[model samples]
Target: MIDSRHRRARLGLVSVTALWGVTFSLNQVALHSMGAATLTFLRFLVASLFLLLGFGLRRSFWQGVNRAELLGGLLTGSLLFGGYLTQTEGQRFLSASLAGFLTGLSVVLVPLILLVLHRGLTRRQFGATLIAAVGLYLLARPQGHEGLLGIALLLACALFFALQLVAVEYYRITTAAVIRFTLFQMATVTALAALVAMAPGGGGLLPLHASQEAWATVAINGVGASALGFMAQTWSLRWLNSIEISVIYSLEPVFAALVALIALHQREGLAVWIGGIIVVVAMVLVSITPPGGATYPQESST
Candidate 1:
Protein backbone atom coordinates (compact mmCIF):
# COMPACT_ATOMS: atom_id res chain seq x y z
CA MET A 1 0.00 0.00 0.00
CA ILE A 2 1.17 3.52 -0.69
CA ASP A 3 1.96 5.29 2.54
CA SER A 4 0.31 8.53 3.54
CA ARG A 5 3.49 10.45 2.86
CA HIS A 6 3.84 9.15 -0.69
CA ARG A 7 0.18 9.79 -1.32
CA ARG A 8 0.60 13.35 -0.11
CA ALA A 9 3.58 13.82 -2.38
CA ARG A 10 1.58 12.57 -5.32
CA LEU A 11 -1.21 14.98 -4.50
CA GLY A 12 1.25 17.83 -4.27
CA LEU A 13 2.70 16.98 -7.66
CA VAL A 14 -0.81 16.76 -9.13
CA SER A 15 -1.58 20.22 -7.84
CA VAL A 16 1.64 21.50 -9.35
CA THR A 17 0.73 19.95 -12.69
CA ALA A 18 -2.67 21.64 -12.63
CA LEU A 19 -1.07 24.99 -11.87
CA TRP A 20 1.30 24.47 -14.78
CA GLY A 21 -1.59 23.55 -17.07
CA VAL A 22 -3.37 26.78 -16.24
CA THR A 23 -0.26 28.68 -17.29
CA PHE A 24 -0.58 27.42 -20.84
CA SER A 25 -3.55 29.71 -21.45
CA LEU A 26 -2.41 32.45 -19.10
CA ASN A 27 0.96 32.69 -20.82
CA GLN A 28 -0.72 33.10 -24.18
CA VAL A 29 -2.32 36.30 -22.97
CA ALA A 30 0.80 37.54 -21.18
CA LEU A 31 3.09 36.88 -24.15
CA HIS A 32 0.89 38.93 -26.42
CA SER A 33 2.02 42.11 -24.66
CA MET A 34 5.65 41.33 -23.72
CA GLY A 35 8.65 39.55 -25.13
CA ALA A 36 9.24 36.03 -23.84
CA ALA A 37 12.41 37.18 -22.14
CA THR A 38 10.64 39.98 -20.32
CA LEU A 39 7.85 37.65 -19.24
CA THR A 40 10.32 35.07 -17.98
CA PHE A 41 12.36 37.65 -16.10
CA LEU A 42 9.36 39.13 -14.37
CA ARG A 43 7.94 35.72 -13.49
CA PHE A 44 11.11 34.54 -11.81
CA LEU A 45 11.73 37.90 -10.20
CA VAL A 46 8.37 37.71 -8.46
CA ALA A 47 9.05 34.15 -7.39
CA SER A 48 12.47 35.03 -5.99
CA LEU A 49 11.15 38.00 -4.08
CA PHE A 50 8.35 35.93 -2.57
CA LEU A 51 10.81 33.25 -1.51
CA LEU A 52 13.16 35.79 0.03
CA LEU A 53 10.36 37.33 2.00
CA GLY A 54 9.27 34.00 3.40
CA PHE A 55 12.78 32.70 4.15
CA GLY A 56 14.15 36.01 5.40
CA LEU A 57 17.77 37.23 5.28
CA ARG A 58 19.73 34.98 7.55
CA ARG A 59 23.45 34.31 7.59
CA SER A 60 22.87 30.64 6.92
CA PHE A 61 20.62 31.45 4.03
CA TRP A 62 23.36 33.32 2.20
CA GLN A 63 26.63 32.27 3.81
CA GLY A 64 26.08 28.57 4.48
CA VAL A 65 25.51 27.71 0.85
CA ASN A 66 27.64 24.69 0.00
CA ARG A 67 29.38 23.98 -3.27
CA ALA A 68 26.96 21.24 -4.16
CA GLU A 69 23.91 23.47 -3.79
CA LEU A 70 25.56 26.30 -5.71
CA LEU A 71 26.70 24.08 -8.55
CA GLY A 72 23.45 22.17 -8.63
CA GLY A 73 21.38 25.34 -8.68
CA LEU A 74 23.46 26.83 -11.48
CA LEU A 75 23.20 23.68 -13.58
CA THR A 76 19.51 23.11 -12.99
CA GLY A 77 18.61 26.77 -13.36
CA SER A 78 20.55 27.08 -16.62
CA LEU A 79 18.86 24.01 -18.04
CA LEU A 80 15.46 25.37 -17.00
CA PHE A 81 16.16 28.75 -18.60
CA GLY A 82 17.34 27.02 -21.77
CA GLY A 83 14.23 24.89 -21.85
CA TYR A 84 11.91 27.89 -21.60
CA LEU A 85 13.93 30.04 -23.99
CA THR A 86 14.15 27.45 -26.70
CA GLN A 87 10.51 26.47 -26.36
CA THR A 88 9.48 30.11 -26.74
CA GLU A 89 11.67 30.56 -29.78
CA GLY A 90 10.44 27.31 -31.26
CA GLN A 91 6.82 28.35 -30.81
CA ARG A 92 7.50 31.40 -32.96
CA PHE A 93 8.17 29.10 -35.88
CA LEU A 94 6.01 26.06 -35.13
CA SER A 95 2.29 25.67 -34.64
CA ALA A 96 1.18 25.91 -31.02
CA SER A 97 -0.01 22.31 -30.93
CA LEU A 98 3.16 21.03 -32.53
CA ALA A 99 5.36 23.04 -30.23
CA GLY A 100 3.48 21.76 -27.19
CA PHE A 101 3.80 18.18 -28.42
CA LEU A 102 7.52 18.59 -28.96
CA THR A 103 7.95 20.14 -25.53
CA GLY A 104 6.12 17.19 -23.98
CA LEU A 105 8.81 14.96 -25.47
CA SER A 106 10.66 15.53 -22.25
CA VAL A 107 8.51 12.84 -20.72
CA VAL A 108 10.18 10.29 -22.96
CA LEU A 109 13.62 11.79 -22.58
CA VAL A 110 13.59 11.67 -18.78
CA PRO A 111 13.65 7.90 -18.46
CA LEU A 112 16.31 7.68 -21.14
CA ILE A 113 18.49 10.14 -19.24
CA LEU A 114 17.96 8.23 -16.01
CA LEU A 115 18.99 5.02 -17.75
CA VAL A 116 22.25 6.62 -18.79
CA LEU A 117 22.80 7.60 -15.17
CA HIS A 118 22.52 3.91 -14.15
CA ARG A 119 19.04 4.39 -12.74
CA GLY A 120 16.90 2.55 -15.22
CA LEU A 121 13.16 2.25 -14.67
CA THR A 122 11.33 -1.00 -14.17
CA ARG A 123 9.85 -2.67 -17.25
CA ARG A 124 6.38 -1.71 -16.08
CA GLN A 125 7.42 1.89 -15.65
CA PHE A 126 8.96 1.92 -19.12
CA GLY A 127 5.77 0.53 -20.61
CA ALA A 128 3.72 3.19 -18.91
CA THR A 129 6.01 5.91 -20.25
CA LEU A 130 5.53 4.60 -23.78
CA ILE A 131 1.80 4.57 -23.32
CA ALA A 132 1.86 8.08 -21.98
CA ALA A 133 3.91 9.26 -24.94
CA VAL A 134 1.43 7.84 -27.36
CA GLY A 135 -1.38 9.58 -25.52
CA LEU A 136 0.50 12.87 -25.68
CA TYR A 137 0.95 12.55 -29.45
CA LEU A 138 -2.72 11.88 -30.00
CA LEU A 139 -3.81 14.62 -27.66
CA ALA A 140 -1.55 17.12 -29.33
CA ARG A 141 -2.40 15.95 -32.87
CA PRO A 142 0.63 17.91 -33.99
CA GLN A 143 0.55 18.88 -37.66
CA GLY A 144 2.31 21.05 -40.21
CA HIS A 145 6.01 21.42 -40.91
CA GLU A 146 8.27 23.97 -39.33
CA GLY A 147 11.77 25.17 -40.16
CA LEU A 148 14.53 22.82 -39.11
CA LEU A 149 15.85 25.42 -36.72
CA GLY A 150 12.60 25.52 -34.80
CA ILE A 151 12.39 21.74 -34.72
CA ALA A 152 15.94 21.56 -33.44
CA LEU A 153 15.26 24.17 -30.79
CA LEU A 154 12.22 22.29 -29.50
CA LEU A 155 14.24 19.09 -29.37
CA ALA A 156 16.95 20.91 -27.43
CA CYS A 157 14.31 22.23 -25.06
CA ALA A 158 13.08 18.70 -24.42
CA LEU A 159 16.60 17.53 -23.68
CA PHE A 160 17.20 20.41 -21.28
CA PHE A 161 13.95 19.67 -19.45
CA ALA A 162 14.85 16.01 -19.16
CA LEU A 163 18.24 16.88 -17.74
CA GLN A 164 16.63 19.32 -15.34
CA LEU A 165 14.36 16.58 -13.98
CA VAL A 166 17.33 14.28 -13.38
CA ALA A 167 19.32 17.10 -11.83
CA VAL A 168 16.52 17.87 -9.38
CA GLU A 169 16.36 14.25 -8.27
CA TYR A 170 20.13 14.15 -7.76
CA TYR A 171 20.43 17.50 -6.04
CA ARG A 172 17.60 16.90 -3.59
CA ILE A 173 19.70 14.04 -2.28
CA THR A 174 22.84 16.12 -1.85
CA THR A 175 21.62 19.54 -0.77
CA ALA A 176 21.17 20.28 2.93
CA ALA A 177 18.16 22.54 2.59
CA VAL A 178 15.75 22.09 -0.29
CA ILE A 179 14.24 25.55 0.29
CA ARG A 180 17.60 27.28 0.01
CA PHE A 181 18.51 25.22 -3.03
CA THR A 182 15.23 26.19 -4.68
CA LEU A 183 15.76 29.85 -3.82
CA PHE A 184 19.18 29.84 -5.47
CA GLN A 185 17.83 28.06 -8.52
CA MET A 186 15.03 30.63 -8.89
CA ALA A 187 17.48 33.48 -8.48
CA THR A 188 19.81 32.08 -11.13
CA VAL A 189 17.00 31.64 -13.65
CA THR A 190 15.75 35.17 -12.96
CA ALA A 191 19.22 36.61 -13.49
CA LEU A 192 19.89 34.73 -16.73
CA ALA A 193 16.49 35.60 -18.22
CA ALA A 194 16.90 39.20 -17.16
CA LEU A 195 20.24 39.37 -18.95
CA VAL A 196 18.71 38.03 -22.11
CA ALA A 197 15.94 40.62 -21.90
CA MET A 198 18.47 43.42 -21.46
CA ALA A 199 21.05 42.27 -24.04
CA PRO A 200 22.16 44.88 -26.59
CA GLY A 201 20.12 43.58 -29.48
CA GLY A 202 17.21 42.30 -27.42
CA GLY A 203 14.00 44.20 -26.72
CA GLY A 204 14.14 46.46 -23.69
CA LEU A 205 14.83 44.96 -20.24
CA LEU A 206 11.42 45.80 -18.74
CA PRO A 207 7.82 45.72 -19.78
CA LEU A 208 7.27 49.29 -18.66
CA HIS A 209 4.13 49.72 -20.74
CA ALA A 210 2.58 46.31 -20.20
CA SER A 211 -1.15 46.22 -19.54
CA GLN A 212 -2.76 45.48 -16.19
CA GLU A 213 -3.93 42.14 -17.46
CA ALA A 214 -0.38 41.21 -18.40
CA TRP A 215 0.87 42.19 -14.98
CA ALA A 216 -1.85 40.17 -13.28
CA THR A 217 -1.06 37.13 -15.36
CA VAL A 218 2.61 37.49 -14.54
CA ALA A 219 1.81 37.78 -10.86
CA ILE A 220 -0.30 34.62 -10.87
CA ASN A 221 2.31 32.65 -12.80
CA GLY A 222 5.08 33.90 -10.58
CA VAL A 223 3.51 33.10 -7.26
CA GLY A 224 1.54 30.02 -8.23
CA ALA A 225 3.57 28.28 -10.94
CA SER A 226 7.14 29.43 -10.38
CA ALA A 227 7.33 29.76 -6.62
CA LEU A 228 4.86 27.17 -5.32
CA GLY A 229 5.09 24.80 -8.24
CA PHE A 230 8.90 24.66 -8.31
CA MET A 231 9.31 24.32 -4.58
CA ALA A 232 6.69 21.58 -4.43
CA GLN A 233 8.50 19.75 -7.22
CA THR A 234 11.83 20.02 -5.46
CA TRP A 235 10.38 18.80 -2.19
CA SER A 236 8.48 15.96 -3.81
CA LEU A 237 11.59 14.68 -5.54
CA ARG A 238 12.69 13.34 -2.21
CA TRP A 239 9.77 10.91 -2.20
CA LEU A 240 9.37 10.08 -5.88
CA ASN A 241 11.76 8.74 -8.50
CA SER A 242 12.43 10.64 -11.70
CA ILE A 243 10.52 8.24 -13.95
CA GLU A 244 7.50 8.40 -11.68
CA ILE A 245 7.68 12.16 -11.68
CA SER A 246 7.88 12.30 -15.47
CA VAL A 247 4.98 9.95 -15.95
CA ILE A 248 2.84 11.94 -13.56
CA TYR A 249 3.71 15.21 -15.24
CA SER A 250 2.53 13.86 -18.60
CA LEU A 251 -0.96 14.62 -17.35
CA GLU A 252 -0.24 18.32 -17.59
CA PRO A 253 -1.50 18.66 -21.14
CA VAL A 254 -4.55 16.64 -20.28
CA PHE A 255 -5.32 19.12 -17.53
CA ALA A 256 -4.69 21.96 -19.95
CA ALA A 257 -7.23 20.56 -22.39
CA LEU A 258 -9.78 20.33 -19.63
CA VAL A 259 -9.17 23.92 -18.61
CA ALA A 260 -9.64 25.09 -22.17
CA LEU A 261 -12.83 23.13 -22.58
CA ILE A 262 -14.42 24.42 -19.40
CA ALA A 263 -13.03 27.92 -19.09
CA LEU A 264 -12.60 29.01 -22.70
CA HIS A 265 -15.33 26.83 -24.22
CA GLN A 266 -12.74 25.41 -26.57
CA ARG A 267 -13.75 22.18 -28.21
CA GLU A 268 -11.45 19.19 -28.30
CA GLY A 269 -11.57 16.59 -31.01
CA LEU A 270 -12.23 12.88 -30.54
CA ALA A 271 -8.51 12.18 -30.51
CA VAL A 272 -8.07 14.39 -27.48
CA TRP A 273 -10.75 12.57 -25.52
CA ILE A 274 -9.23 9.20 -26.36
CA GLY A 275 -5.77 10.46 -25.56
CA GLY A 276 -6.83 11.86 -22.22
CA ILE A 277 -8.26 8.49 -21.23
CA ILE A 278 -5.08 6.70 -22.24
CA VAL A 279 -2.88 9.08 -20.32
CA VAL A 280 -4.99 8.70 -17.20
CA VAL A 281 -4.77 4.94 -17.54
CA ALA A 282 -1.01 5.20 -17.79
CA MET A 283 -0.93 7.31 -14.67
CA VAL A 284 -3.03 4.74 -12.84
CA LEU A 285 -0.74 1.92 -13.88
CA VAL A 286 2.31 3.75 -12.60
CA SER A 287 0.63 4.82 -9.40
CA ILE A 288 -0.54 1.31 -8.52
CA THR A 289 2.70 -0.45 -9.34
CA PRO A 290 4.50 -1.76 -6.30
CA PRO A 291 7.53 0.25 -5.31
CA GLY A 292 9.49 -2.73 -4.11
CA GLY A 293 12.40 -4.08 -6.17
CA ALA A 294 12.47 -1.04 -8.42
CA THR A 295 15.85 0.03 -9.75
CA TYR A 296 15.10 3.73 -9.36
CA PRO A 297 16.42 5.28 -6.16
CA GLN A 298 14.33 7.35 -3.75
CA GLU A 299 16.01 9.72 -1.32
CA SER A 300 13.93 10.62 1.70
CA SER A 301 15.73 13.58 3.20
CA THR A 302 18.32 16.16 2.26
Candidate 2:
Protein backbone atom coordinates (compact mmCIF):
# COMPACT_ATOMS: atom_id res chain seq x y z
CA MET A 1 0.00 0.00 0.00
CA ILE A 2 2.84 2.40 0.80
CA ASP A 3 4.50 1.67 -2.52
CA SER A 4 1.20 2.17 -4.32
CA ARG A 5 0.73 5.52 -2.59
CA HIS A 6 4.20 6.61 -3.66
CA ARG A 7 3.45 5.57 -7.21
CA ARG A 8 0.27 7.64 -7.17
CA ALA A 9 2.20 10.63 -5.89
CA ARG A 10 4.72 10.26 -8.67
CA LEU A 11 1.91 10.19 -11.21
CA GLY A 12 0.42 13.34 -9.74
CA LEU A 13 3.78 15.06 -9.97
CA VAL A 14 4.05 14.03 -13.62
CA SER A 15 0.69 15.65 -14.32
CA VAL A 16 1.81 18.84 -12.55
CA THR A 17 5.00 18.98 -14.61
CA ALA A 18 3.04 18.59 -17.86
CA LEU A 19 0.70 21.40 -16.85
CA TRP A 20 3.68 23.60 -16.05
CA GLY A 21 5.28 22.72 -19.38
CA VAL A 22 2.27 23.87 -21.39
CA THR A 23 2.19 27.13 -19.44
CA PHE A 24 5.44 28.21 -21.06
CA SER A 25 3.73 28.55 -24.43
CA LEU A 26 0.54 29.91 -22.91
CA ASN A 27 2.51 32.52 -20.96
CA GLN A 28 4.35 33.56 -24.10
CA VAL A 29 1.04 34.18 -25.83
CA ALA A 30 -0.33 36.18 -22.91
CA LEU A 31 2.85 38.23 -22.68
CA HIS A 32 2.29 39.50 -26.19
CA SER A 33 -0.45 41.76 -24.83
CA MET A 34 0.35 42.03 -21.12
CA GLY A 35 3.49 42.96 -19.20
CA ALA A 36 5.13 40.28 -17.08
CA ALA A 37 4.10 41.90 -13.82
CA THR A 38 0.50 42.32 -14.91
CA LEU A 39 0.24 38.81 -16.30
CA THR A 40 1.77 37.29 -13.16
CA PHE A 41 -0.53 39.30 -10.94
CA LEU A 42 -3.66 38.23 -12.78
CA ARG A 43 -2.51 34.63 -13.03
CA PHE A 44 -1.81 34.18 -9.33
CA LEU A 45 -4.83 36.28 -8.40
CA VAL A 46 -7.06 33.83 -10.18
CA ALA A 47 -5.11 30.92 -8.72
CA SER A 48 -5.35 32.16 -5.15
CA LEU A 49 -9.06 32.78 -5.54
CA PHE A 50 -9.63 29.29 -6.83
CA LEU A 51 -7.63 27.77 -3.99
CA LEU A 52 -9.41 29.91 -1.42
CA LEU A 53 -12.79 28.92 -2.76
CA GLY A 54 -11.95 25.23 -2.78
CA PHE A 55 -10.32 25.14 0.64
CA GLY A 56 -12.85 27.49 2.19
CA LEU A 57 -15.50 24.86 1.68
CA ARG A 58 -13.94 22.83 4.48
CA ARG A 59 -13.93 24.08 8.08
CA SER A 60 -10.63 22.33 8.82
CA PHE A 61 -8.87 24.42 6.18
CA TRP A 62 -9.36 27.60 8.14
CA GLN A 63 -8.35 25.98 11.39
CA GLY A 64 -5.20 24.62 9.79
CA VAL A 65 -4.00 28.12 8.86
CA ASN A 66 -1.98 29.93 11.51
CA ARG A 67 0.75 32.53 11.96
CA ALA A 68 3.59 30.01 11.67
CA GLU A 69 2.27 28.58 8.43
CA LEU A 70 1.72 32.09 7.11
CA LEU A 71 5.33 33.00 7.85
CA GLY A 72 6.59 29.88 6.15
CA GLY A 73 4.34 30.61 3.21
CA LEU A 74 5.72 34.14 2.90
CA LEU A 75 9.27 32.88 2.57
CA THR A 76 8.44 30.12 0.08
CA GLY A 77 6.06 32.31 -1.86
CA SER A 78 8.61 35.09 -2.18
CA LEU A 79 11.03 32.61 -3.70
CA LEU A 80 8.30 31.30 -5.99
CA PHE A 81 7.35 34.84 -7.05
CA GLY A 82 10.98 35.62 -7.87
CA GLY A 83 11.20 32.49 -9.97
CA TYR A 84 8.04 33.20 -11.94
CA LEU A 85 8.83 36.88 -12.46
CA THR A 86 12.32 36.18 -13.76
CA GLN A 87 11.15 33.26 -15.90
CA THR A 88 8.34 35.30 -17.45
CA GLU A 89 10.69 38.18 -18.15
CA GLY A 90 13.27 35.84 -19.65
CA GLN A 91 10.65 34.13 -21.83
CA ARG A 92 10.06 37.48 -23.48
CA PHE A 93 13.52 37.32 -25.05
CA LEU A 94 13.77 33.54 -25.61
CA SER A 95 11.86 30.89 -27.47
CA ALA A 96 9.50 28.80 -25.42
CA SER A 97 11.73 25.77 -26.03
CA LEU A 98 14.84 27.61 -24.91
CA ALA A 99 13.06 29.07 -21.91
CA GLY A 100 11.92 25.64 -20.87
CA PHE A 101 15.43 24.22 -21.16
CA LEU A 102 16.96 27.08 -19.23
CA THR A 103 14.38 26.84 -16.45
CA GLY A 104 15.04 23.12 -16.07
CA LEU A 105 18.48 24.05 -14.76
CA SER A 106 16.75 23.97 -11.40
CA VAL A 107 17.13 20.22 -11.55
CA VAL A 108 20.89 20.64 -11.58
CA LEU A 109 20.78 23.37 -8.99
CA VAL A 110 18.76 21.26 -6.54
CA PRO A 111 21.55 18.84 -5.67
CA LEU A 112 24.06 21.62 -5.18
CA ILE A 113 21.63 23.44 -2.93
CA LEU A 114 21.06 20.26 -0.97
CA LEU A 115 24.79 19.76 -0.61
CA VAL A 116 25.18 23.22 0.86
CA LEU A 117 22.44 22.41 3.36
CA HIS A 118 24.50 19.40 4.57
CA ARG A 119 22.84 16.71 2.49
CA GLY A 120 25.49 14.25 1.30
CA LEU A 121 25.74 13.87 -2.47
CA THR A 122 26.74 10.57 -3.97
CA ARG A 123 29.42 10.25 -6.67
CA ARG A 124 26.60 9.76 -9.15
CA GLN A 125 24.99 13.04 -8.18
CA PHE A 126 28.26 14.89 -8.78
CA GLY A 127 28.63 13.29 -12.20
CA ALA A 128 25.04 14.11 -13.05
CA THR A 129 25.59 17.74 -12.10
CA LEU A 130 28.66 17.95 -14.32
CA ILE A 131 26.73 16.47 -17.24
CA ALA A 132 23.86 18.85 -16.68
CA ALA A 133 26.21 21.84 -16.53
CA VAL A 134 27.69 20.95 -19.90
CA GLY A 135 24.20 20.50 -21.27
CA LEU A 136 23.19 23.96 -20.04
CA TYR A 137 26.19 25.56 -21.74
CA LEU A 138 25.39 23.91 -25.04
CA LEU A 139 21.69 24.54 -24.72
CA ALA A 140 22.24 28.21 -23.94
CA ARG A 141 25.04 28.85 -26.47
CA PRO A 142 25.12 32.60 -26.92
CA GLN A 143 23.04 33.87 -29.83
CA GLY A 144 24.04 37.50 -29.17
CA HIS A 145 23.43 40.17 -26.52
CA GLU A 146 19.66 39.57 -26.11
CA GLY A 147 19.98 35.83 -25.98
CA LEU A 148 22.77 36.09 -23.40
CA LEU A 149 20.60 38.33 -21.26
CA GLY A 150 17.70 35.89 -21.50
CA ILE A 151 19.91 32.99 -20.47
CA ALA A 152 21.25 34.96 -17.53
CA LEU A 153 17.74 35.83 -16.38
CA LEU A 154 16.65 32.24 -16.75
CA LEU A 155 19.61 31.12 -14.66
CA ALA A 156 18.44 33.44 -11.92
CA CYS A 157 14.98 31.95 -12.29
CA ALA A 158 16.49 28.51 -11.86
CA LEU A 159 18.25 29.59 -8.69
CA PHE A 160 15.08 31.01 -7.23
CA PHE A 161 13.20 27.87 -8.16
CA ALA A 162 15.82 25.74 -6.46
CA LEU A 163 15.51 27.77 -3.29
CA GLN A 164 11.74 27.51 -3.40
CA LEU A 165 11.91 23.74 -3.74
CA VAL A 166 14.22 23.41 -0.76
CA ALA A 167 12.05 25.78 1.25
CA VAL A 168 8.94 23.77 0.43
CA GLU A 169 10.62 20.61 1.68
CA TYR A 170 11.65 22.29 4.90
CA TYR A 171 8.15 23.63 5.44
CA ARG A 172 6.58 20.31 4.65
CA ILE A 173 8.75 18.63 7.25
CA THR A 174 7.66 21.09 9.89
CA THR A 175 4.00 21.64 8.98
CA ALA A 176 2.76 18.45 7.25
CA ALA A 177 -0.50 20.13 6.29
CA VAL A 178 0.06 20.31 2.54
CA ILE A 179 -3.24 21.85 1.53
CA ARG A 180 -3.14 24.67 4.06
CA PHE A 181 0.49 25.37 3.35
CA THR A 182 -0.12 25.56 -0.40
CA LEU A 183 -3.13 27.82 0.06
CA PHE A 184 -1.13 30.31 2.08
CA GLN A 185 1.75 30.22 -0.39
CA MET A 186 -0.63 30.89 -3.28
CA ALA A 187 -2.17 33.79 -1.41
CA THR A 188 1.26 35.23 -0.68
CA VAL A 189 2.31 34.97 -4.32
CA THR A 190 -0.88 36.67 -5.42
CA ALA A 191 -0.29 39.54 -3.03
CA LEU A 192 3.34 39.98 -4.06
CA ALA A 193 2.56 39.88 -7.77
CA ALA A 194 -0.26 42.37 -7.35
CA LEU A 195 2.08 44.75 -5.55
CA VAL A 196 4.60 44.53 -8.36
CA ALA A 197 1.94 45.19 -10.96
CA MET A 198 0.68 48.23 -9.09
CA ALA A 199 4.13 49.66 -8.57
CA PRO A 200 5.20 52.85 -10.33
CA GLY A 201 6.26 52.39 -13.98
CA GLY A 202 5.06 48.75 -13.80
CA GLY A 203 1.94 47.61 -15.60
CA GLY A 204 -1.45 48.20 -14.02
CA LEU A 205 -3.09 45.58 -11.86
CA LEU A 206 -5.52 44.52 -14.57
CA PRO A 207 -4.51 43.43 -18.06
CA LEU A 208 -6.77 46.01 -19.68
CA HIS A 209 -5.22 45.85 -23.16
CA ALA A 210 -5.07 42.03 -23.32
CA SER A 211 -7.25 40.24 -25.86
CA GLN A 212 -9.70 37.38 -25.45
CA GLU A 213 -7.04 34.85 -26.38
CA ALA A 214 -4.66 36.28 -23.82
CA TRP A 215 -7.33 36.15 -21.14
CA ALA A 216 -8.14 32.56 -21.96
CA THR A 217 -4.49 31.61 -21.78
CA VAL A 218 -4.07 33.28 -18.43
CA ALA A 219 -7.23 31.67 -17.10
CA ILE A 220 -6.07 28.21 -18.11
CA ASN A 221 -2.63 28.69 -16.62
CA GLY A 222 -3.93 30.36 -13.51
CA VAL A 223 -6.33 27.57 -12.70
CA GLY A 224 -4.61 24.55 -14.17
CA ALA A 225 -0.91 25.38 -13.94
CA SER A 226 -0.66 27.61 -10.89
CA ALA A 227 -3.44 26.53 -8.57
CA LEU A 228 -3.82 22.85 -9.34
CA GLY A 229 -0.21 22.33 -10.33
CA PHE A 230 1.16 23.81 -7.12
CA MET A 231 -1.28 21.91 -4.96
CA ALA A 232 -0.42 18.69 -6.69
CA GLN A 233 3.28 19.35 -6.22
CA THR A 234 2.81 20.03 -2.52
CA TRP A 235 0.89 16.84 -2.09
CA SER A 236 3.41 14.82 -4.06
CA LEU A 237 6.26 16.06 -1.92
CA ARG A 238 4.65 14.19 0.95
CA TRP A 239 5.84 10.99 -0.67
CA LEU A 240 8.90 12.21 -2.64
CA ASN A 241 12.10 13.86 -1.52
CA SER A 242 13.31 17.17 -2.93
CA ILE A 243 15.80 15.46 -5.24
CA GLU A 244 13.16 13.07 -6.53
CA ILE A 245 10.79 15.91 -7.19
CA SER A 246 13.45 17.88 -9.05
CA VAL A 247 14.28 14.91 -11.24
CA ILE A 248 10.64 14.40 -12.11
CA TYR A 249 10.25 18.10 -12.84
CA SER A 250 13.16 17.91 -15.30
CA LEU A 251 10.72 16.29 -17.75
CA GLU A 252 8.95 19.64 -17.95
CA PRO A 253 11.15 20.87 -20.78
CA VAL A 254 10.39 17.81 -22.90
CA PHE A 255 6.71 18.47 -22.56
CA ALA A 256 7.28 22.15 -23.30
CA ALA A 257 9.21 21.30 -26.43
CA LEU A 258 6.38 19.05 -27.59
CA VAL A 259 3.81 21.79 -27.03
CA ALA A 260 5.95 24.34 -28.83
CA LEU A 261 6.33 22.01 -31.80
CA ILE A 262 2.64 21.23 -32.04
CA ALA A 263 1.23 24.69 -31.34
CA LEU A 264 3.91 27.11 -32.46
CA HIS A 265 5.71 25.06 -35.10
CA GLN A 266 8.92 25.73 -33.24
CA ARG A 267 12.20 23.91 -33.70
CA GLU A 268 15.61 24.19 -32.08
CA GLY A 269 19.06 23.72 -33.59
CA LEU A 270 20.92 20.41 -33.62
CA ALA A 271 23.17 21.53 -30.77
CA VAL A 272 20.15 22.35 -28.61
CA TRP A 273 18.58 18.97 -29.30
CA ILE A 274 21.74 17.16 -28.31
CA GLY A 275 22.17 19.31 -25.21
CA GLY A 276 18.56 18.79 -24.22
CA ILE A 277 19.01 15.06 -24.55
CA ILE A 278 22.04 15.20 -22.27
CA VAL A 279 20.11 17.13 -19.65
CA VAL A 280 17.25 14.64 -19.79
CA VAL A 281 19.73 11.80 -19.39
CA ALA A 282 21.23 13.47 -16.36
CA MET A 283 17.80 13.78 -14.77
CA VAL A 284 17.12 10.14 -15.52
CA LEU A 285 20.29 9.20 -13.71
CA VAL A 286 19.23 11.21 -10.71
CA SER A 287 15.80 9.60 -10.70
CA ILE A 288 17.11 6.04 -10.97
CA THR A 289 19.82 6.44 -8.36
CA PRO A 290 18.88 5.38 -4.84
CA PRO A 291 18.86 7.92 -2.06
CA GLY A 292 21.91 8.27 0.20
CA GLY A 293 22.02 8.79 3.96
CA ALA A 294 20.17 12.08 3.93
CA THR A 295 17.36 12.25 6.46
CA TYR A 296 14.18 12.84 4.55
CA PRO A 297 11.20 13.55 6.75
CA GLN A 298 8.48 10.98 7.22
CA GLU A 299 5.77 10.96 4.59
CA SER A 300 2.53 12.65 5.58
CA SER A 301 -0.90 12.37 3.97
CA THR A 302 -2.33 15.51 5.55
Please report the candidate that would top lDDT against the real structure. 2
Predicted candidate 2 versus true structure: per-residue lDDT over 23-56, tens digit per residue: 8898888888998988888888888889878776
Best by TM-score: 2
Model 2 C-alpha RMSD vs. true structure (Å) is 2.1
- Residue by residue across 1-302, what tens digits does model 1's lDDT show? 45777788899999988877676666666667788888878888899898998884766667667798888988998998898778766655654434444565677777667566776577876787789778766754533355456667877987998899889888887664677877777888899998999997555567778888789978998899888888988888767777778777777766666665666565656775676577666655654436484434566444
Report the C-alpha displacement of residue 227, candidate 1, in angstroms: 1.4
Q: All candidates' TM-scores?
A: 0.82, 0.93
TM-score of the candidate numbered 1?
Answer: 0.82
Worst 10 residues of 2 by lDDT: 287-296
Candidate 2 backbone collisions, by pair: none
Q: Please list the residue runs of candidate 1 whose C-alpha ends up more than 4 Å from where it truly belongs after superposition.
A: 91-101, 119-142, 146-153, 264-291, 295-302
Local distance difference test, each candidate: 0.74, 0.83
